[model samples]
Target chain A: MKRRLFICSFAMATQLFFAATLVLQPARAGSEDAKSSPTEVRVDNFTFSPETLTVPVNNAVTWVNKDDVPHVIASNDGLFKSKALDTDDKYSYTFTKAGSYSYYCSVHPKMVGKIVVQ
Target chain B: MAKNDRFDPSLSGFIEHDHNNDGIDRRGFLKCMAWAGTGALCVIEGGILKSYALGSQKGSAIRSHKTASFSFVQISDSHMGFNKPANPDVIATLKAAVDKINALPDQPDFILHTGDVSHLSKPSEFENVDQILKATNKEIFFVPGEHDVLNDDGAMFRERYGKNSKGQGWYSLDKNGVHFIGLVNVMNLKAGGLGTLGQEQLAWLEDDVRHLTSSTPIVVFAHIPLWTVYPQWGWGTDDSTQALSYLKRFGSVTVLNGHIHQSMQKVEGNITFHTAFSTAFPQPTPGAPEGPGPMKAPAEQLRSVLGITHVNYVQGRHALAVVDSSLV
Candidate 1:
């Protein structure tokens, strides 16, 4: 079991290393207005836009609530959770490890999303 | 709108939408009301269902007053502090609800706020609701909606609402020979989005009703609908079946819930599940194109879509008669 876990981490580490190079690059001029990275998720109309997101290890991602109702983001595992994000409120999390993550709005579980930390 | 369309809130003067109790029977009456868009007061006298539309009743549920031994109002999803296009001034609408409750023939024994007393779980939100609900001058009981427990895992909600309750605020009360069990199912929600009444609460539920006789009438109030209204929308509870199994021996079980933000009713054998409307806003029906959220009803019809439920318990009756009254 330990060996298998190690093998999985090694694979993820390689993917994370490659992923880092993609996001670690500096943004071209005027590119800030048009995000070059998938670092933000918007909660609107009881849904997470870009239902799936991928980022490199240690990359920070933020979720902003644009809807009038409040929403809570909670990871499937006992990992990260957010306080209720009311309209125009935001919560951010930085992934430090490489793996697949699943989350949903605790207030409305039907609104689900995923984050792939490579 | 069609002339006879039942949803017209403009209708006036005590209209009994369906008075042919002889043909419909209780089962058929429920089947019809389950699809009814307007509010109704259904009185079960001697196992027959007699219903009156609230659009004309003004608030009194007058027909059932004679047979009802006691009545309590159920209001859900007040969503205090909700300032969306749906219903900009939730306070005004909630005050309207208080007015409707106060207008009833005999003041309901108490009020059951099924859940969502606050929109954002903020202290101020709860306080605003407290101030508005105080006008009824009736004691209010609560179960927290998922929205209520969002911040601090419901620390603020339990502190303000369920001080003497147990385990994330689940408790049971006995009043006038009727048993009321308040359950909490919004804490520690599981992934894939479904309501959960964890093992601990289920165990407590089993032990809670152990002593009641089979003749007892049980009313279960919670934030989420226990029956599977639409699992795709996370409208149902994961472990509610087990919690309900504990109450199977009882003659009648009525489950009142909120969070769907629309009125819906379902009957399954001995159990009847009814969901109340939000005093603040309406929501889409199950399986709508956009998904469920604070639905924006046209301003004029907003009050008609939002409503409260009145449940009357007649001594020795097979079931409690439920009356849903709109804020208008």
Candidate 2:
């Protein structure tokens, strides 16, 4: 009778352990994704801070203008265009497919930045 | 003419013209005006500039001046999208300019906006300027300012205004016996560099003007000053010398510009270089303590410093008579 009780308790504990693992796995994976995606570039002093950025597919990248004057981020291939971003203005675009994108400021053409998506 | 010169100083001003073949006579008049005052109207006749200040002894002498063949208004640096404290309401100021143009005693044949029609190259901003300018009932010509070409290499601006223009939006039009060349120099800027007319545009310009007679009056308008107005602020054009070389043969070459946001005039040989005031905001003088940007002054005085230019092309004048007036 005691042996039967021990077996039954062990089975219940095993099932509970499996249930816990099943619930925790996706949460762990989701946090990892949130950590991996880097999605921002800063504009200040007439330049993009991370002139080159890398991101995952379907991730969005935001460009925030911190300069006193105005700026614009335009893709070379006519993919994306931002309006004149005055101070504190922000522009964002999502990378749906994996590719490389190059852009420059329309005001200051010398100011350029690149993005690579994997 | 000699008998009348002894009694009237204003008549003596005309005597100076007889000696203008030497080019020293105009310089002497400029020196006299500098010592007298800056508020004076100067008329160029047969290559001589005669000054007549308002209420001066010679002011009425200019009233009998011959009628102009045609006249046009020059509005620059409207900067419609700018919402900063320096000039929060650019649209209002631009409207005032249009009102000023509409109220002119003689309606202009057309209007030439030197550049900077928008502050941020926003499509909405362009549309706003178009809407306001439409109220003037005058045809408008546009060249891209650096600000106008900020997005997609000015793809939006070119689409709207440069549809009939060549690459980078440089084109020429012949109107009423006058040849007007609109140039693009604000594109492809270097680091804090001066404006440039690339080799492509320069070649095109040479070919464009090749067939025209030297007697044809050429009006070249661009965003930045073709001359080195103030290189320290990147206010000059790099390849303008080459562009001006193509125009040297012309009897009257008027190069009008508008980046400085203030009125400044210079005459070199047959070329008359004039920079107009902005309709948006005034920038600091080139050598002021602060570098170039929107400058803040007394709020009420802003409009008094920002305005448009009126140019009259008299039939026999050496060049256009440029008059700059503040909105106030």
Candidate 3:
């Protein structure tokens, strides 16, 4: 009887340890997402959230559109341009060299954003 | 003034931009009144100008009047392949527009597709618009709306619709003594800018009209509003004032534009600026409290702009591939 009770407790402890790891896995991945990609800009209501962002060198930035209307993310100096992003569509660009890059919506030029890589 | 008697100068500044106090509210009211005055047919007889309200009085005057030479129908913003709650089937509405154009007692000489001919600049979208418009059997003239120049920057648009057009799809046609200039203002837009006619296009426009006699009635068509309607909404063109200066010598000038999705009109001196309704959906009129935010359509025939949005995770995706020449 004593042996059986001990075995049951040990099994429950292992199961709890594994379950805790399963729950923590996504949170860990999310933090890593924050660390690696480091930046996210949202296009909403005809404006870019964080209209300006600052990040370290070699970091990637992703612009996700939150508007139903299509928007194109284009750099001012003609360095980079993205395809027309539909609702929930995203375009990612990495900054290997530090610089101040200005961008705007090619479709609606009134919408503008900037990124400063230091 | 009554719809039938629109020529009376008492019409107020309906064709001009609304003042700050009356901007959206009054124009919002006209959206309803437009049902009564869908198209304004005008004729210059002897020395005076006469206007006809198409929907209200079926213009027996135009038929009986011997001076009326030619007429063309304008349909703007087909937005083909747009399947949204606002308008699930844009094809049907375009067909209805064509039907109305054909049903006119005097068959129009041609059709003017003022832009937004496609939803995403997809080949299929352009192809679909082409196949559907064949029912009209009229020579269709086109200008590239911002929507039409997506993807490859209007290369597809120029290839399909701009055969005889020069540089950026601008061209002039002389139809029944009316000099029609289709300008391309939806190109190479700078950050925080309105629609632009580049320096090259401006020079071209200057020379295009230099030789025409002042008596020749001029019709200017473009994708964006040449006159300032709402700068905050990007409803106006940036270099249009310069473009208009070239036309000042002319006695009669008509500017037809499409982009706002709802129709509005203004007459600044002899230049009549008019915007046409979109065939796919209706956007909320500008100057609303919430601002004209990202086509939040609703109101007019189709209330609500028909879209929702959320962020997407790129998941370690690489930077996108881009080309130098796009969005002309």
Which predicted model would earn the best DockQ? 1
Going through the candidates in order, what is chain B's TM-score? 0.87, 0.86, 0.76
Q: What is the RMSD, in Å, between candidate 2 and the native fold over all Cα?
A: 13.9
lDDT of each: 0.76, 0.72, 0.66
- Model 2 lDDT tens row, B110-217: 999988898878889999999999998888999989888775777888899989999999999988789999999998765445798899999999999999998898
Which of the numbered candidates is closest to the native, going by highest lDDT? 1
Instruction: Give lDDT tens digits, candidate 1, residues B195-233.
Output: 888988888899989999988888999999998888987
Q: Give me the chain B TM-score of candidate 3.
A: 0.76
Q: What is the TM-score of chain A alone in each candidate?
A: 0.68, 0.68, 0.70
TM-score of each: 0.83, 0.71, 0.75
- By lDDT, is 2 or 3 better? 2
Can you rank all candidates by lDDT, best first?
Answer: 1, 2, 3
Supply every candidate's count of residue pairs whose N, Cα or C atoms clash at under 3 angstroms: 1, 1, 11
> Which residue runs of candidate 3 sit more than 4 Å off their true CA positions?
A1-38, B1-67, B293-300, B303-328
Model 1, residue B176: distance off in Å is: 0.8
How is the predicted docking of candidate 1 categorized under the CAPRI scheme?
A: medium
Report the lDDT of model 2 for residue B105: 65
* TM-score rank order: 1, 3, 2
Q: Which candidate wins on TM-score?
A: 1
Q: What TM value does model 1 have? A: 0.83
